[model samples]
Structure formats: C-alpha cells, structure tokens
Target: MGSNMLFVRDITPRKVNFSLRVKVMKIQIMNGKGYDSGKKTLELIVVDEQGDRIGVNIRHVLKPKFESALREHHHYILRNVVVVDNPVRFRSIHWNHETKLMFTHKSTIIPFESSQWTGPEGFNFLQFSDLKSPVLLKAGVTADVIGRVNSYGNIKQRGQTDDIPSKFINFELKDLSDVVVSCTLWGQFCIDFYNYMKKAGEDQCVIVLIQFGTTKDYIGELTVSSDWNFTSVLIDSDDVPAISDFRARLLELHANDNSVGSLAPMLTPPTNDLTKWFKDVKCVGLDDLRPDNPGIFVVHATIIAILPDEPWSYIACKKCNKKANTVDKNVDLTLNIDELLALERYCKKCGEKPKVQLRFKVSVRVEDDYGTASLTLFETQIQNYFDKSAYELQKSLPEDQDQPDELDELLGKSLLFKLEVSDFNRDRTYANYTVKDATTDSQFIQVFNEKYQTHKAGDDSYSFDVVKESSTSKVTSSTKGDSTSTTDGSQAVDLTADSDNSPLKKRIKTEPGTSPMSFSSSTNKPN
Candidate 1:
C-alpha cells in the first residue's frame, strides 16, 4: 500500500468526516428523479489499492459539485466525506461502511493521472469454476468475469414488474481454461452490449470484461447477470492487461493451428437426431403454409426472389431473433450530460436508450408448383443455410453496397426448410413462416424431386444422387464411379463431412441466366 493510501477496512461510520483517495470502479444514476434538480444522486463503486471495495452515494444536492468531475475507472481524492453503514438492499461492494461525499462550500476533489496505479486495480475477476464455489454460492456474494463469447442467444423481454418488462440477452462465455458459462445481460446492459458488438466489428472472438456481475440459477445451472445499475461491461478493452493477454492468447492459439472450431465441441452441437427428426416430419408445400394452422412443418422450396434493397441482416434480440431497436426513443438527445442522467429514471426493462445490433434477418421468397411465400431467416439458420456467418457476409461487402451478391447467390437454389409458424398477434391473421433450418440434404432434395418432378434425364436439368448418412460414424462415396450419372450441367457434388451430422448447404447454381441445375452426391469422412 502507498504511504498516503487509506485502507477501506479502516473506515467506520462516524459523525466526523474523513478523506480518502480511491479509484472509481463505476458510477450509476438512480431512476425516477425530476430533471429540475441541479444535483442528482448517484451511486459509486470505489476501491483502494489493497483491493478493498466500498459503496459511495453522493447526495442529490452535492451532485453538481462532483458528478461532472467524477469519471469511472479513474482515481480521485476526496475531502470531508462522512462514513455510514452500507444499506443492505443497495450494497454494491462487500465493505461494511459507505462513504457519503457531500458538497459543502469547503469540500475539495482532485483528479489525478491513471499512471498512479501500478497495475490493473479495483477488479477481482473470478474464473468460470468460481461460479460453483461455496463462497459465491452464498447470498450477496458477487464478482467480475472476463471471457470470450462462444455463442449468443436472442434478446427477449422478461416481465420484472407489473408495469415494465426487462430486456435481456443470453450468451455463452468461455474462460481461458476453456470452461464455458452461461451469462445474461439485463436491462440497459443488454442494449449496451448488443450495440457494442455492432460498432466494434469483431464478433465472437473478442474478449469481454464484466464487472460487478452476480450469479443466479438459470435452467438449474449457475448463470451470471448484471447487477442492477452496478455491473459494467467492457468489450475488447486493452486498458486491462488480462484482456490484452487474452487477445494475445487467442492469436497464439490461432498461430499454432488451433482453430476457433477447436472449441466447437464445447458448444452443445446440434444432435445427430436432427436427421431422424427431419425425416419423421411431414413436408408441406409453400401454398399449404397457412396462418390458420400453427405448427412446425417441413418444406422443400427454391428461392425465387431476394427482397431488393433490404439489408439482408440486422442485430437481433438474442432470444427472439427480432430486431433489437433502441431501448428508448423518448430521451432527449440534445442535452449532453443531463440526457445520460435522465436514463436512470426508467426501469431496466424499458431501457433508457437501448442499442441496436446487426444480426441476420434474411428475407427471401420461396416457391414450389403448389405455391410461393415469403419467409424470414435469422442468424443460426442463416449461418447453416449459407455455410457462412452473417458477420462475414456483412463485412465482405463494399461500404457503398448494402446488398451483397453473396446473399444474392442464395437465389434459385433448392433447399429443405423446417418452417415454424408463430403468430405475431392473437388474431393469427398475420402469421409468418420463419425458416428454422435450411439444408440441401438428400432427403429434402428427393422429396423435391418426387413432388415437383421438375428434373428429367433428357433435359439438361440437374438431379441429386441419394446420399445415406449414418449418425454414429463417418461415411464417404466416390464421384469417379458416378461420372456416367452426371450431365453436362452437373458439377462435382462433394458433400463435406459434418461431425454434427447436420446437412450442409450444398446447392446447384445455374451458369448465369439459366434455370437448369444439377446435383451429384459424393461424401467424405466426417470432420
């Protein structure tokens, strides 16, 4: 400890005031305050060099004197502050007493350089293993976590109070040891994180730092969510050495020929049963899809139209796959600091100003002889359908063009889709068919061939050879022996080995301006 540093444990509730220099870990404004007050009550999480943390609340009247000068993650010198017992309900730190910094005419505050700290200060990040530790399992225990995002779920609204529902995004995170944990961001935290990923450009690989997060039971498993108004999120932040080291570690792993897919198994892969699951389902034609019936159905269709001028993707709610719009549009954007302070008045679910992210929202029109319909496809299915990530497709385009040809290439390809019908409203008059999964497997292709009978031997039209894949083991077949079956329009049909056994999107495209297409099947050992 520095000679001038004051230990937090030594501070006790007293009538007389005291002074201490501490780093402001975070500051959050409370909600429901009128904008007229010049001073706004704010909560602060501060820590000493010894890693001791204490909560601090600046009274509303004293806020004007200190709020503008106070910056998070910065060291501050405080004078004439009273110490009191921490309110149990609002405690953000473990310390027994909280500092009450007031704005007396004589009060003094000094902002010092960040270089004063010898190393990363004020954070005690726990490992994924720590979530199950006995101490953390006890009530009121909280800590920080740093990890790489493995996969993210959709953002959804959860009812918190009778009046307002809180928004959340569920995501899986992995620590350096490759231990995976489920994490959810609540309220504004969800909005902030979703928007952060959008602007940062780096997707799954970026390291994230979570502070003041608390643990809870989710689906009978331990999970973490941002503690109200206390938790802070930083994505790919280099200010912390742990984050910087994590970035280097990822680079090193990639350099060593360790692919990010090495962690793919850690993810709960789509089950092999998905094939049998698809087989047992009855297939429906595009015209047969009805708002009158709400059920999951299988459909073999070809993309007939790509909606023009629509950005093929958007950042969606991790849970719902709906566009994640700003949490609040009512907040005044003209004022600088006051607008930020005003955000605290709304409940976490309503959000002060939620951020929108980019997720896949591919809209395509599909058709069969029975009928044609428009369908919406979100991230997971889109990734499966295209064999590419929405982020990759989005980034590959030139800045001037919003509609990439990569998406345009999806047109005129035959696919089998698991369609889900969910009514957006109660009437069911406006139900939409969402593409749950899209694949070019033998089963779907055979169904298309049998139902449509669009392909003929004499015609230059292409036909897919039936492929039998076993769930438990790898399978391979040769293209050399099948040359006689392939027509001039038929390209080499090589089915990539997929360990999960989910069919890959291998479509037969025409040679520009021609509808004639062909498919030949050759399989390789599953990778």
Candidate 2:
C-alpha cells in the first residue's frame, strides 16, 4: 500500500521505511512540555500484521496533515517513515525502534483493509487492588483496568486553572474481588462516559475498561486517573467477553445479597460536599435567604401551618422511589378472585408488582420573624424530623379517632432544614426551595443559637416551648382554629376553618408530657 512499506519487526533505526496494515492501538495528543513546551504532538501505538507493536511520533508541524487519518483500533498504511529508538520510559511495546512519521515530504498515512487485521484480543486489564505494585508505579508507566461501576459522583472542574480545559467524573468502581477504588475520568473520557450512561438509561451492571491509565497517591490513598491525552474508556460492549463475564458476576451478587440497604445509596441523589457544606454553612432566618445566591443552604424555622387538604403521603415503588399507581384488576378478570386481587397490587411506575411502601410527603408553611416560606419534606427527611417512620405513624390512630396523633406532634416544632435554592421566579426570588434534609441535630441548633443569640428554650411566638411541668401556662394557637386533643392529651390544631369533616378534629386524652407507644405497620392499617 506504500512505497517499500515493511512490517514493524523489520523496521530499523536511522533507516527510512514505511509500515503496512498496522492496527492503531492508542493515540494521544501531547501538548508542549519542557523544551518542546507549547508545541502539539501526536503519539500513536500500532501493531503490525505479525502482532509486533511499536510507537509512532508525529511532530507538531505534521499533525494537521496526518493526525486525523489515524484512529485507535483501525488499520492503516504508512510511507517513508524514519525509525528511531524507543523512549527510555513508558514503553508500551517491546520494540527497540519507534517510527517518526513526518509530513508527506518525508512520510504519509493511508487507510488499509481492517478486516484482514487481528487486533488485540482484549485489554491487559490490571486488578484494582494491585494498582500499587512498584513496577506499575514507575514514573511514566500506565496500565489498563476493567471494573463494574458502583457509584457516580458530580462532575467537578479544576479551580482557576487554564492548562486543564475539561472536568472530571468521580466514580467508584468495584472489581470481582469486591475491592473498591475511586477513579476519575478527565476531559473527553468524562463526556463519553456520561453519554454512554445516558444512552443506557441506567448505570447498574455497567462494566468499564480504562486503557493506559496511570496511578497516583491522593491524600495517602491509591487513586487512578486518566493519563494526559492518552487514556481511552470502553463501556458495556457486548463484543467484549471480559465485560460480559463481569455482568454475569454482578447479577449473581445482586441475587445473593438480601440487604436492600446496600443499594439505597446508588438510587439516592449524591450528597454534594456534605462535610464542607455542614462545616462552613450557617443557619439563617427565612428573610436572610437570597434567591439570587443559589446553592444548598440551611434554614431554621417553625412550622406555622399544615395543609391537611393536600396529600400527606404517597404510595411509592420500593425499587425506584417513584410514585406508583395501582394496576387495574379488571383487565385480569379471567383469573380467579385471589389471582385478580394480587394483580391489583402491581405498581405502574416500575412496570412490575414490587412490594409497595408508604412514604410521607407533606407540605407546610414555615415562618420566622423575617418571612414565611413553603417547605416540602419527603419520606426519609420527614422520618428524620419526626423521629418516626411513615408506617409507624400511620398505624397509631385509636379506634375512636381517625387521624393519627403524630401529625399533631409535628406542628409548631422548630426544625433545621437543608434547602436547595433553585429555579428563580420573575421577581428574582426563588420559586421553590426543595427540602433535602430535616433534622434536630444539636450542631445545627448550636449554630442557629450562636448566630441569632437565642436560647434553646423557645421564646418567640412561633416557637413551641416545652410547657414546664410546674407552670400553669397552656399551649396557645397562633392561627384562629379549633384544637383537637389526641389520646395523648396533646392538642391537634386544625387551621382549615372550612374543613367540617376534618379527622384532625379528633382528640385523644392523656396526661401532659406523656408520649404514646410507637405503633408499627403490623399493629394496624390506616384507611
């Protein structure tokens, strides 16, 4: 295909010759460094028809002419190449001489028949646990690794650095031995991994191969990241036998692992900079929150009103945490009553009959001296705030009372809410603040008291002060409403003046400061 094109094994240093049917294994864009700083060069790895491999250096001036014609795993033909000695370090191929392909005046590249070439059978995959080997840690050395992705982190950029133009994806990968390591993919590798994940629609059971990756010690831990301009990532390919086998092992692990808690972190949204956000963040009043300054922030406020008219909970598919609608049993009328009844329990969200769980989802108005804002809490956060599970609370109603006593216990309590401020309105104020987490964590309370100079004993009108046992003071309602006492003797304040049939009006009798016994789903089912 080229004038006197020879096999890689036949090439000699200082002699000018071409190579034929060479399959490209790797290509890297090397920018200027040291003496060659500011110049852009191309380093190519190719294997000849005899399975012998060698590196090819394309000088900066010749890049515009030949860089685009070469692609990894593709066969190519070259002409008039000058052979030279291999680099002293980072030797990927066992060859004494490498090729230097210059502009057409000295060399040329041409497309060749790919079907006739036998490329690499698979990557020389290195185990994650063995990444710290002395031989693998040598400067300029690199290796390949294949593992299953276990977690995905947010994409982050370098701080005020112009030399690096791309962001990195922080991912957690686990090998067959179950050892886990944190990996970062930079630049195009990050973008390509995201695109592949998007196309796959789900990240589970994904096996990834990172080629020519280098390892480094980050904060006393062994970490692996892409080598500058060289590493390529392959994900979830049916043609790769190694990846296919990993998929089988992953399925087996999932089947044998009965603990659902191990999988929850993967389904939940990643907590963004938890320790940093907590340490540096100060709890502010509602009025002090600026919608223009969008980020995750903390707020301490007292619940002023609960919208009892709205849904207080949701039926969610256990697997995906999505709102689920019960399937219609009429479609399966041909089945017996028992079978048809079972069919009705299926969830539409996940397209399967997963065991459904009730999750608490409530909307309420919270207020401070400065302003009032709407707050919404989902199951996990609500459970944290009330210190009771939705199932437990739902089953706590007495035979004479319709509404559970837990709802009344939550009213008037001051809570620290971690809010995500996003989606500003036309007025420049945030349209909504999503409640990420709710807690009575002592650290939060300490921070709030230090900032506002308020005692832990609630004194403000909105605060729910624990009534002293000796004091004659009684609970007071901020809004004009009829109070329904629970069986525990705690007042259930109903602000819905128009709600004539509100079960919140039910009152249970008990001595003050006495808490009712916690109920579970097994105790009773709520209508």
Candidate 3:
C-alpha cells in the first residue's frame, strides 16, 4: 500500500528581499479519462531556492491526497518585481445584483500626471554625466532635457512593408548639466506641435521626457521613443531651476552641452532670401523664359513645365508596345497571343500612356542689376508649394487666341521691386537681393536696371606696333681703287597692324640690305 498518514509540519515565514529567489508549493488537479471531464492524471516537479526538484502526484478535487491538502498552505516566493516603488493604488467598488455582494477593483495610478513627466521633488535638472547608464533608463526616472522639435515627418511599418505615413518635427535636447539628445514626434503630434514650433520660429528650446529602446532603422541609427505627452512642454531659460539648486547639481553630473550640433555635418545654407526676391519681383508669365540657361540673371528662378492633369489613354499592343526600329509598323509587327497576354497594357513605371497631352510650363524669375533670367521649378517642388500640377495649370490657360490682355501688358516688366542687395556673384558680375517692398507701374515704378546704367567713353584710343623693312643699294669709291665692297644697312620696321587689320596685332620688321617690312593681323594683342 502507498504511504499513508502523512504528518503536516509548520515552517516559519522569512522576509524576501530584492533579487532573492524563493519557491512556494502549489497543488494541481489531474483527472483520468471520463473522470471529471476526461482529463489526464500526471505528476509535477516543484523546484526551490537551491533548484532542488521534488515530484508529487496530483490529486482529484475530492480526494484526501497529499497534493490536495498541501494546497491550503500559502507561501511567499518573491519580493517587488520592479525597482521603483509600486505606483499608487485607488479602489472602486461595484455591487453585483445576482450575488448581492460588493466587489472591489484596484487600479495603479501615477500621482503627478501632467502633460509631461516631472522630476522628483526638489529635482532641478539632469545632465548626461549623472546617468549611471545613459543609454538605458528605468521608467519613472525624471531628468531635465533640452531638445529641439524636428520638423520632419515620421516613419512606420505595418507587417513587413514600410509605411511612412507621417513626418516628425525633430529636436535636439540638451541640458546645462551635460545631457544632450535628439527627439522626434510623428503624425498629429507633428501637425500640432511642429506647426506651432515653426510659427514660434526656429531654435526654440523645449523640455521632454524620453524612453529608450533598441530599434532597427533604415539607415541603422539607434533611436529613442518620445510621445506628444512626453514632449509637449516648452521650457525657457528663466523657467529652469537655478544652478545652485539640488536638481541643477544633478544635471551637472552629466556631460556638457558643447557637443550638440557636432553630431551632424552642416548642410547648404537656406535660399530663403533668393526665393523671397523672386516672389516679390513682377514679370510677364514664366513662358517667355527659355528652358535652357534662362540667362545668368535668373539662374535661381524656380521654373516648371505644366503637364496634363487628366490620365491619358493609349492603344497598346496585345504584345509588347515596343516600337519597331523600322518605320514600317505593319512589316515589323509580330502577333502572338501568348506574348500579347503577357505584355503590360499600361506603362508600369508611369500609370499614364507613353504619349500624353501638352502641359503649361512655369518658372520663377531671378535678376541682378545688369540682367534678369528665369529658372524652371521642379514638378515635386511645385506640387509641394502650390499643391497643383503643371498639367492642371496648362489646362486652365486660355487658348492662344483668347490670351488675357493683362498678361500681355505684364510681359517684360519687373515683378519684384525695392529689393535690397545682400550679396554678389563670385566675379562681382551679378548681385543677389531681397525684396523689402513691392511696386507697380501704376505706382510710378522705377526699374532698378534702368536706374543704374554703365557706359564706355567714346574717345578711348590704344597703341599698336608696326614694323617696316626696306633693302637699298649704295656705292662708295676709294682712291687708286675701284669701287670697294659697298655697305648697306636695313631700315628698322615698326610693329603695328595695318588699317584693315586689328591694330593690336601690328608689327614692324627691319633687315640688313633689305627694305623695312611690317606685318599686321586682326588678332588682339596679349595684355
């Protein structure tokens, strides 16, 4: 027979500390086939602090077995699971009509719930050096951080595909104590917070709460998590705690703020001034400007060609629509049902037909004192700024015969007025400016190019060299001697061009026993 009459023993309870491992005994029920709903019977092993495993048989609900009786003994196994103090708890009671009894439910709540997290009482600021593990932080650890909101959007992924539905307003946070980091927010947060930020102007400082996690980015950069609630508060210099405060000292424990923007290289400076000048300047419609080298003056002008707004249709080959090299379409055409079936009816790259309707072109004009030019705007930039396509603009224009008279009058006239010069081109040949005011012909417009004119003096003269050479015969006589050897010297020639050639290339030559000769050409002389 199995062992019977097992004695029960009582043990003293011991207090458990953090990170201490302990074990408690638990009784489980095991039923056989058709016994209490066709369950299987089994034995389980319970392990203790030293990892010693003990096996015991499970008993039926009504059985006076070892497992069933041991269930009455309650024991403690572990202490607090998280390092932080347990969040505060609140209780709510509910009455159940069926049971006629009151039940209580407990909830965990944070005491200081603002739009953002606040540090401990008397906490001043957090610096990078104060963080024992700056890379990873436990929840509820509050520290002051300074960062800028990034204006860029967010990126998301659903299942395996990348879905960048929203962008972020990016910011770099730093504290006087040495804490510095970047923060980003997406979607509604961006629209709400970032829009306000842009209106608030750039380089504004704000405070934020951040959570750290490992994430795989497209570019492989490690990123941290931030939410609207975590990043909503704006903290100015005056709002920060004084440096002498305890919290301020904690902030100073971390690194300094000197290394902030050093993380990324500088990009090309913004061209806002140039853009503003174009918008202020007046001119005829952008059509008059050439597509190529719209001249040096308007090199920075934003230009674009309007495209068809509506989708186009095409008669595609049942097979490949690839055109035959030979002009004879009928002779070069090859028909095959299978090939035609496989051929794509539409161009996969662009959803429209290979051929489409004409669209209007648009451009922004740039000018200097000496001249003006137009630049084509890219389609994407146009869409971003105007929220319209080139095709849509083209379709809206009146036909050549019905062109507006106002447009004609505006042609060849200045669009921007009262621009202040800010910079000049590398060779000082061109100048850049910003528009401080605008003017119209009706308001007594004064064209800047006309206001400043350059002219050359009419009486300017330059010198040229001319060379002439001539050979001459001379006779000499000596007493009691026939004419001895006659001596002759060549004349010097001037270096100058002839009247028919450019004066710069003229040259004169001289030779012994020869007439002076001069040579000239149309080429300019080297200065």
Q: After superposition, how far is residue 324 of candidate 1 from its true place, in Å?
A: 26
Q: What CA root-mean-square deviation does each model show from the true structure?
A: 17.4, 20.1, 31.8
Q: Judged by TM-score, which candidate is best? A: 1
Give per-residue CA lDDT, model 2, range 190-300, as digits (tens).
666655544442323567777666665654455667766566666766466776787677667776665422322231111222233354444566665555666656777
lDDT of 3 by residue, 1-527 (tens): 21121111111122112222222222333444334356533322222233222223332442332333232122222222222111211100110001111001211111222222221222223344433343533332223333322222212211211123234334444444334443444544434443443343222322333321111121223233333222223322234344224234433543374533232211111122123223333233122233221222211121111212211111222122221121223331253323332343343333443432222122234333223432222221122334333344434545542222222222333332332222222223222222222322111111222211111222212121111111121111000110100010111222121122211211111111111111111111111
Report the Cα lDDT for residue 285, model 3: 17
Where is the poorest 10-residue window by lDDT in model 1?
Answer: 475-484
In model 1, how large is the Cα lDDT of residue 210? 78
Task: Please give the lDDT score at residue 384 for candidate 1.
Answer: 36
Predictions in order: lDDT = 0.54, 0.53, 0.26
Candidate 1: count of backbone clashes, pairs at least 3 residues apart or interchain: 18
Residue 493, model 2: lDDT of 31
> What tens-digit string does per-residue lDDT give for candidate 1 at 50-141?
77677776667666777778887789777666665553433333442444333455566777888876535757777788666655443354
